[model samples]
Every structure is written in C-alpha cells, then in structure tokens.
Target: MRSNAARNALSGCLGFALIVLAGFNAAPARAQDQLKVAIGQINNWENQAPTLGQDAGIFKRHNLVLENV
Candidate 1:
C-alpha cells in the first residue's frame, strides 16, 4: 500500500514538472525593439558611455538603444 502511494506521489510530481516545462517552452519569444537615438556631440570622450552601454547589453537591459552622431 505504501509503495502504491509513493508511486502516485512520484507521478504527480512528474506531471507537475512537465506542465511547468511545457508552459515555459510554449511562451512566445519577446523581440527587443531597436531604438534610434541621436546624441549632440560625437567629438567628446564623454559620449563613450552610451556607446559602451549599447555594446555591453546594458542599454538593452534598460530597454534603450542609442545612436550617436
């Protein structure tokens, strides 16, 4: 009787895991929107941070895309 209970518990756990995995897999991929932004100054080194942020994925994390001129 105990073995039957254990088997049922295991099956239930597996079923729950499968459902969670399926939910994750069925979710749609989110496409990040690319932004076109203009910075007033390109001649100065102070403008480097925005360029670095975009290149290092920091801007994407904050949902920003910068275009400097």
Candidate 2:
C-alpha cells in the first residue's frame, strides 16, 4: 500500500493537471493563428529541407512561422 503522503501528492498533481486542462478548454479560440519556430542547422546538408520548405511556402500553408537561429 502507498503511504498517505504519497497518495496526497499524487492526488494534488492530478487535480492541478485537471484544473489546467479545464482552463485551456475554457479559453477563447482565434480564427487565424501562427506558431513561431526556429530552425537551426548543424551543416549545409541539414539546411536543405527547411530552405526548400520556405521556398515552397509549406510552412505558411500550415500556419507555422519559422525562424533561423
């Protein structure tokens, strides 16, 4: 059997998670939304896909705003 402290901690965590989820669910929705992202490449070879994706406007189509670091 679990100790009382352990059980209390677990229940507290579960309750906090539930409240956070409910808060998100109660928030208003936006019609147009974009998420900012930064893409970094280790070398020239790794940079090809994002470059091509930017040229192809694939990220814009998916409502993602990518940035380089």
Candidate 3:
C-alpha cells in the first residue's frame, strides 16, 4: 500500500540520520584542546587532582589537557 511505502521511506530516512549522527559523535578531538578548570576560594587536596593527573601523564595519554586555575 501507499501508506506502507511511506512508512518504509520514513524509516530509511531515520536510519540514515542516526548513522550521520553517530559519525559526528565519533569524531576525535584535536590534540591542542585543553580543559580549563577553575578552583575558586580553595586550593587543597580536593582541588589539586587535575594538576596531579596532568603531571602523572594520565590526561595526556587520554588526549586531554587540564589547565587548572
């Protein structure tokens, strides 16, 4: 029927859209993308994790740049 054809066409369009969205979501980040984290009014063990993780090379290994402020 015409309604069945229309439904199939719509389903195909939706499937293509989902594939395009998945491709966009899977795109990799650039190497120079740095994350800036602000620690206001307090600088202690709790606030020092980002810097510590950066120093430990964990962030670099995961392609993340942590900028603590």
Candidate 4:
C-alpha cells in the first residue's frame, strides 16, 4: 500500500510537470513574431482570456496576432 501511494504521487507530480512543459512548448510566439489562433467559440472564460488579453494589448505587447474565428 505504501509503495502504491509513492508511485501514485510520483506519477501525479510527473503529470503536472508534463502539463507545464507542454504549455511552454505550445506558445513560442517570439520565434515567429506573429501567430494565427482560431477558437471555435467565445461563450466561456476559457475562450475569453485570449480575447481579453488581446483587447488589453497583452498579445500585441508580446508581438502576437491572436484571432477568434
């Protein structure tokens, strides 16, 4: 039981790390200087953050072209 708990904890930590790394790898805006992002809908917070960020000039500050289609 103790070994199983340790393995589970290790896996959980690794999974969290994987997600963080993936997020970093997914957004390489500086390398391109421009990006075309497409969202299916903007009816929720998940779809709203980017729009708000763009409206707030955050994406332009970072030299990105985040568009919702």
Best by lDDT: 3
Task: Report the lDDT tens digits of candidate 4 across residue range 1-69.
Answer: 479889999999999999998988895545526666777566877878877898999878777777566
Estimated TM-score per prediction?
A: 0.50, 0.39, 0.47, 0.45
lDDT for model 4 comes to: 0.79
Report lDDT (Cα) of residue 34, candidate 4. Answer: 60
CA lDDT of each candidate? 0.79, 0.74, 0.83, 0.79
Candidate 4: which pairs clash? none
For model 2, what is the alpha-carbon lDDT of residue 64? 67
User: In model 2, which residue pairs have backbone atoms overlapping below 3 Å?
Assistant: none
- Tell me the lDDT of model 2 at 57: 93
Residue 17, candidate 1: C-alpha displacement in angstroms: 8.0
Model 1 root mean square deviation, Cα atoms: 3.8
lDDT of 2 by residue, 1-69 (tens): 999999999999999999999998995754545555456664677766766786799977776666645
Query: What ranges in model 3 sit over 4 Å off?
Result: 1-32
Give lDDT tens digits, candidate 1, residues 1-69: 479889999999999999999998896767776766676676678867778788898978876666665
